[model samples]
Structures are given as C-alpha cells and as structure tokens.
Target chain A: MDYDYIDRLLERYWKCETSLKEESELRTFFSKSDMPKRFLPYKDLFVYQQIQKTVGLGSDFDVRVLSKIEPPVVKAKRLTMFVRIKPFLRAAAAVALIVLCGNITERSYFADDKLDYNYKDYKDTFHDPEVAYKKVSSALMMLSEEIKKSKSQHFPDSLYQNDLDSVCTK
Target chain B: MHEFSFQDDILPLKDKLFRLALRITMDRAEAEDVVEEAMVRVWEKRESYSNYDSVEAFCLVVTKNLALDMSQKKDAQNLSLDESMAESEMDESDPYHQLANNEKLKLIHRLINELPERQRLVMQLRDIEGESYKKIALVMNITEAQVKIDIFRARQKVKQRFLEIDGYGL
Candidate 1:
C-alpha cells in the first residue's frame, strides 16, 4: 500500500498540473474502500465528485427531452380505412355543403321567381277609371301640400336667389 | 462532415447536460427544464450543426447559458442542494458508516456549491464530467488558461473549506 503516486497526483491535481487522465486516476484511487487514513479527509471530495457524475435526470428524462427535441415523430398512424380517407372525407363534406347551399339558394330563387310572376299577373285594386283618377288627384294634392310646407320651413327660393345675387354683386 | 443524428448523437448527451444544469441551478426541476430547453434549442439549429466544429461542445454551451439564465431568474444560485436527490447507490452495510458518509457528502456538496460561478462550473466540467480543458473553455467562452486558473482556485477553495469543517468537527 504505497500511496506515493496517488499523493503526488493529488498534489498536482490541487495545483491544476495533472492531466485529465491523471485526475481520473486520482478519482479511481479515491473511489476504493481501503483509502489511507491520511487521505480520508479528501476522500469524500473525490468520491463526491464521482457520485455527482451520477447526478443525472431520471429514466423518464430521455423520454421527456426526446419528446421535446425529436418533434413528436408523428408516427404515421397506421391509417385505418377511416384515417386514410380523412382528406377525402373533408373534401366530400365541403362538396356536400356547397351542394346543399346551392340547392337552398336555387329553391329560394325559384320562390322569388314565383313571387315575381305573381306580381306580373297583378290586378288593380281600383277597378273604375273615374275612382282611380280621383284617388291620384287627391294623392298628388297632399304630396304638393307637404312639399310646400317643407320648402317654406327651409329658406324660400326668393331668399336663396337674393343671397346668390348678393354674392354675385360682391 | 459527420452526420449528427439526434437520437444517436445528441440524445446521449442528456445526462451530461443534466448534470451541468443541475450543478448550476441546484434545482432538479429547474435543471430539467433548462436541459429540455437547451436540447430543443439545439435541435432547432440542427441544420446548422455542421457549421460548428463540435456539436457536443455547442450543446454544453447552450445548456450552460440556459441554466445560468434560469438560475438567475429564480435567484436560486444560493439554494441548498436537495439531499434526498443525492442518494448514492453505494450499498454500505453499516448504518453508522452510511450516515457518516452521507454527512461528508453533504459537506462536500455545500463546499462545491459555495464556490464562485466560474470556478464551480470549471471544476464541475473538468473534475466531475471529465471534460477536457479545451471543451470547457469552449463551453464557458473562456481561454484554456482561464479554465485552468478557475479549476485550481476552485479545488483550493473546496480543499480549504473541507479541511476547515473537518478540523472544526474534531
């Protein structure tokens, strides 16, 4: 049990003079159970460093990290007949929607055409020409009265003409 | 150009990246999150991985930056190590020895954690993960000489504090 080499390597290790391999040797030497009493104080440090090497994430760590880094490998889900036809199903749905919409629109348009045809077959509510002429005259007279009231409430045409003349004179 | 497969190449680095993240954040959950984000970030740039000299080094850099950022955001730099998480697989027949060893392991963890960020990271990358100086320097964005300096200072501080604690116990 000569520990001269280990002691020297330890000394060099403290001085940062040992190579990585030499430092590794010191670690291996300290890892043994039968360490010299003089080296006991420092043994824990080396052994702890060795143990720290094992301070890794759990077995699930790889799974967790790979899930993040590997991009969820989108395992080509064994495309069942249903899955295989998914795109076609989507297209078929879109086409069915379009056809349904088209049918509804066409039916609505036909209903509108029927309404238009009914309008073309319209009959006058007033049957007699004399009664129709009297109603038209009264409606025209009321419209003219309303128009005259609105026009009077606003600027009169004579006033507007005076303002325009003033501006022209100016 | 070596074809870098995510499963074959990058996925395998998870444990190493986890350990690095765990070292920085001192929170298993936060560390896991950082590692996940780093892996996803690297995977996103998988197309440009060939442009880099070493994808592994690039991944380490990404993990380090992400861990540092998260730890800073949470202000978890001074958080205590989760003793339960550090359970070693070593089967010690004697309960007394196991308790003593566990105590020593805790002290060692605290000592390492108390180190300055750069020194702690350098020591972790070098002594624990068995990374080369070149790789560590690349990951830390420092010179190889600076990596060596930090590691030396880190080792000295750990040893000094370990000795002080052991001395006080006696």
Candidate 2:
C-alpha cells in the first residue's frame, strides 16, 4: 500500500495546512492496520487520539445530570400539590399571626392591673383632703432634709472621685 | 430553531464536555463538576440557544469557560502535567507491543497537556472531538485563521518534542 499521499497529508496536518476533510482522511488511514514503520512514531499519537475520543462520562451520568437540571415529570405533580395548598397555607399563616397579635395586645392591657390597684390605694388615701395635704407636706420636707444631709456627706467625695477618674482616663 | 431535548441532545454531550473539562482541569472530579455545571447552564439558558449558530459550539465554550474559571478560582496548578504520566500504564499481558504503545501514548498525552492554553483547546476540539475549524473558532471565540495557526503550532510542538524525547531517551 502506497502511503506517499498519507505522508504528504501528515506533513500538511503537522503544519496545520490540511482541511477538515483531509485530516479526517488521515485519521481514517492511521486507524487501519499495516501502517509502515517510518510512520510508527506518529501512529500511536493518532491512535491515542482515537481512543481519547472514547474518553466519556459514565453510563449513569445522564441520569445524574438530568435529575439535577431538568426536574422530572414527578416534579410537575409536586408543583401541582404545592399550587393547591399555597393559598390555604397563606391564609392559615395570616390567621395565626393575627391571633398572636390579638393575644399580645390583650396581655399588655392586663399587665397594667397592678398599677391600677396602686392608684386605688392612692385614691383611698386622698379621700380625706386636709389630712392628705398635711401628710404630703411632711413627706416632702423629710425628702428635702434627707437630700441635703446626703449632699453634705457625699458631694465632696464624689467630686474628688470624678476628678481622679477623669485624670486616670486621660 | 431546533428544540433542545435533554435526552436527545444535551445529555449526549456529557462525554464531550467531560473530555474537554478533563483536558483543561486534569482532575476527573473537577472535570465532572465542570461538565455538570455546564449542563445546568445549558438547560437554564435553553431559551436563548436559538440565537446561537451551533448548540455544540455554545456548550463547548461554556464548558471551557467554566473549567478555566474553576482552575483560576482555586489557583489550581495544571494537574495534567504530573497525572497523565501516572495513567498511561496499560495491560501488561502484551508486553512488547502494548508497552511501547502505552509509553508513547502517555508521552503524547503529557506533551499535549503541556501545550499553551489556546493551542491545547484548539487541538482538542479539532483532533479529539473531530470538530470542524469553523466550530472550533466559534467555541474558542477566535477567527478560523487563528484556530488554524493555533492547531498548527500545537501539533508541530508535539511532534518536535516527541521526537526529541525519543532521541534523548527521556
């Protein structure tokens, strides 16, 4: 078998001068048996390329990929299920939220009952106006005296401590 | 416009995408991830595929970009450099013929992997995948002339380096 044409084409192929069709012819020629020894160096490379084309994804790869990207027909069924219940689910959630808010408002209003009881006690005390006035005046005077006494005892110490703190911080 | 069927069209591309991804990243797992990602992307962008000239070319471009992006993001060294050497051990039964063939195959694989990025892709698309120059140009987003030049340079480099290795017994 004369490989002169193939050798010429192979040269052209190495130089990237061959067209696609010519390269295909070379590939076909190299793939067959009885390749001459002179071309042995280039034989394995082309054969390896032919084998490399067989390098592929596994048999299960399609199932794996399709499962991920394109949802199965069952997904459409699941979507239908979701579509049926979505409005009801929304309504239920809204109702639950409203109920929760109502309960919170009621609890807040009831929380002030202790303050109401304290107000009742004050109302009872102020029923006797003149006595209440004397009592309030006495209380006010006692608080004023207490404040004045504390100020005299601690104001100097606090002022000195503040100055120390400021100096230390700086 | 042709319809994009997962079973008929997209799923069949898994092998080609896997090979391209594997060629670039040189890690089987990473290549698998890249192909899966590419598959999902093609499915997601199925609507816009009508605008493209070729779906196969579009998918190849996507896979190449994704593989390159993955390598870039992880700062992955070209794992192909070391790994292809380890993978070329064929069956030991046919020692004389198989051993020489396997060594040459491994050397070829490593040499191809060592090619520059553009040339490697061009050679892969042209030689391994049996893609036309026009399709390769579309996938690589280069002119057909550039594709020709890249393939030429890549093939010559492989041939020269291969002969040198044989001569030096490396």
Candidate 3:
C-alpha cells in the first residue's frame, strides 16, 4: 500500500487542517495492525484518543444522574397530584375547623347559665337520676325508723307500725 | 422543538458527560457529582430546553461549567490538596510506547489533562467524544475555527511530549 496518502493526512491533521472525515480516516489507519514504523508515535496518539474515548463514567453513573434528576420528576408528579387534590383538602380542613369552633362556642355559652349556682352543691349528689332517687328513699326510711323508735314510748307500737307501713307503701 | 426525555436523551449521555467531567475534575466521585448536578440542572430547565439549538451541547456546557466550578471550590477548600496534587502529578506523566498499553493510556490521559483548560476541553470534545467541531464550538462558546485551532495545539503538545518520553526510552 502507498504511504503518501496517510502521511499527507497526518501532516494535515497536525496542522489542524484535516476535516473530521480525514481525521477519522487517520484514526482508522493507525488502528490497523500494519501501521508503518515511522508512524508509531502518531499511532500512540490515535490509540490514546481511542482509549480516551473509552474513558467513561462508571456504570452507576446513570443511576446517580437519574437519582439527582428523578426526585424532581417524582416531585413534579407529586406536585400535579397535590394541585389536583388541593381544593378538596382545603374544603375538608375548613369543615373540620368550623365543626371544632362550633363545639367550643356552644360549651362556652352553656357555661354562663350555671355560674350563679354553687358547683359544690351538686358535687355531693349522684349524677344518675335513678341512683339519686334510691339514695333519697333509703334516707327517708332510716328517719322513719328512728321516729317510730322514739315515739314507741308514747304510742302503741302496732298503731305506729300500721301508719308507717301505709306511708311507706304510698 | 423536541421534548427532552431523560431516558431517551439525557440518560444516554451519561458516559459522555462523565468523560468530560472526569477529564476536568480528575476525580471520579467529583466527576459523578458534577454529572449528576448537570443532569438536575438540565431537567430543571427542561421547559426551556427547546429554546436552545441542541440538548446534548447544552448538557455538555452545563457539565463542563459545573465540573470547573467544583474543581475551583475544591481548590479553595484545600481539603485534600496534597493527595489531589499527587494524583494530578501521576496523570501529567509522558506517554512512551515502550510502556505497556495500559500505562500508555494512563500517561496520555494525564498528558491531556496537563493541557490548558481550553485546549483540554476542545481535545476531549473533538477527538475523544467524536463530537463535530460545530457542536464543540457551541459547547465551548467559540467559533468553528477556534475549536480547530485549540484541538490542533493540544494534539501537537501531546505529540511533542510523547516524543520526548519515547526518546528517553531510546
């Protein structure tokens, strides 16, 4: 093979006059195993270029780049989702806040009506109506028994017992 | 105007972004971070992406800027300057053919890194990434002619240094 073409191309390449096509041609010629001995240094340069081309990010590079850019993409999806549901969420929150305020206001208004009464007076009474009625009935029965015992000395026991039974039954 | 799909467009460019970032930052973790940051920035501006001529070029610009910024901050902090400088020294070694292929690769990577920032970036975009000079010019904010000149100078530097290393071996 003639060496003149490659030599000329090499000269043009060194002068920065070679086009991309010619430069690539030089690269290809140098890549072949049969490169001329005189062109060995240039081969090394081209080989260096070839090897440098292979110099690249590690395989994890994509993952790293994707990870950096991915969050925003997911965030964009999330932002759209947030935008879609924003009105409903705001309305729901407003409803909840209104309900809470209504409850608080109602309790405050009712609280004023009972301020005149001593709260301690009601503290002694049973809160359940049924339990309070039972306690009153038992207290009256104990008082009647005491009265009947004390009056037994001045009246007939049978008469007092009959009257007490009628009253108790009623 | 094309809608940028992370999976279809941005994700696939990870290797290219990583290579450019790695070349500038010279630290794998930092490069990964720069690429990730660039991806995030691109995604954030996704709505405005159609305003540009090319998404890939825009992304390259962003990654290059971010990597440059991060490296500058790293230098300011002086957090691990000694270790980083040591690593940089290793990367700046000359490329000699007598060395193993892997060693040559490492040496050339260092050599390229040793170039001026503009030359280094142009070399990476044009030679290694196989980007068209137009795209490289877009990313670098330079003219097509300037891009060619930068690549030419960078290659010449590599050749000269490479020859020096080989002559030492001889």
lDDT of each: 0.81, 0.81, 0.80
CAPRI accuracy category, model 3: acceptable
Off by over 4 Å in 2: A72-170, B76-101
Steric overlap count per candidate: 0, 0, 1
User: Tens digit of lDDT per residue, candidate 2, span B1-170?
Assistant: 66778788788888899889978877677889999999899889988876458677778889999999987765565555345434433323422124235777868877888898899989999998888888888888899999999988998899899888976874
Query: Where does model 1 exceed 4 Å of error?
Result: A72-170, B50-52, B76-101
- Order of models, best DockQ first: 1, 2, 3
DockQ of each: 0.43, 0.36, 0.34
Interface RMSD of each: 3.3, 3.5, 3.4
Model 1, docking class? acceptable
Q: Would you list the clashing residue pairs of candidate 3? A: B91-B110
lDDT: worst 10-residue window of model 2 chain B: B88-97
Model 2, residue pairs in steric clash = none
Q: A1-170 in candidate 1: lDDT tens per residue? A: 66998888888888999998998888888889997789988888888888877666666977877776655556655658998899999999999999999999999878756545556778778879998999999999999999998987699889988998999999
